[model samples]
Target: MKMKGLFLAGLLWMAATGMQARGMEHFIDELASQQEVTRVSLGTAAMALGSMFTDTYGVKHIDVLCLEHCSDEVRTKFGQAIADLHDPDFEPLVSHSENGERTKIFVKIKDEMIREMVICHVDDEVAVVRLKGKIKPSDIEQVIQDHGSDR
Candidate 1:
């Protein structure tokens, strides 16, 4: 009886892991085919592990890609890809475009708390970032404040 229980538990764990891997691979595969991609950075699992010690939250998967000479049409498609990943029930927090450049930020909330954030930017370069966990409004405020100070 003990061996049977162990075998069933192991099988369940393996199946769950496989499904998680497939979901992660789907996005990576989708982005791999795009051309003019100059640089790519992937830190999904790595960042999750590091987040435990940093007192940071709401960052799950991180992928950044820079593309040069990207056309307007391609940029639109990139934005759509990120938009499609968002939860349709709640509207994104920020969606703005100017001078041929675009930026969109999405957030998911549960129990009146921010749970996830996805940010995308396109223009001379394209970047897509996905963060999963908990986030607060003040975090956003501080980031924007610090960014303005840098300039």
Candidate 2:
């Protein structure tokens, strides 16, 4: 009798977890349908195929979602789901608003290097991008060092 109860409880827990993931599936499906998208370290084709065969490790787990005419309801739901899914250890790297636009960056790091970063911006449109895998502060500094003079 006790074993049956425990099995039922475990099944219920698994169902709940699946439902939570389904909430985020809407956004994942939408972002995946975009034509001109990049997967950072991985080529676009590998990223697409990776989605089918295995986990994101081979592709570094990077994902970008750009929506042009997104509704407030969808955006709000996505934000809520993101909050639910994001790591508790993530720290705010940047938070700024100017005029009617806002940009926020949050990151999870260890040993002074970023393990994952989430970049979200809402202005003329909405874009939420997540970058995973090895990303150090030096990678960012290099971008500034290389292109700071261009702009």
Global lDDT of model 2: 0.65
Minimal lDDT window, size 10, model 1: 82-91
Clashes in predicted model 2: 0
Poorest stretch of ten by lDDT in candidate 2: 35-44
Instruction: Tell me the tens digit of each residue's lDDT in model 2 across 14-114.
Output: 98777656543454565555554333345456676876875443235667776665666656554454444443467878877889677778887888878
Q: What lDDT would candidate 1 get against the real structure?
A: 0.65
Go through the candidates in order and give each one's C-alpha lDDT: 0.65, 0.65
TM-score, one value per model: 0.56, 0.54
Clashing pairs in 1: 60-132
lDDT of 1 by residue, 52-105 (tens): 777454555555655455677775676666555444434488888999778887
| lDDT score for residue 68 of model 1 | 55
Give the C-alpha miss distance for residue 11 in model 2, angstroms: 19
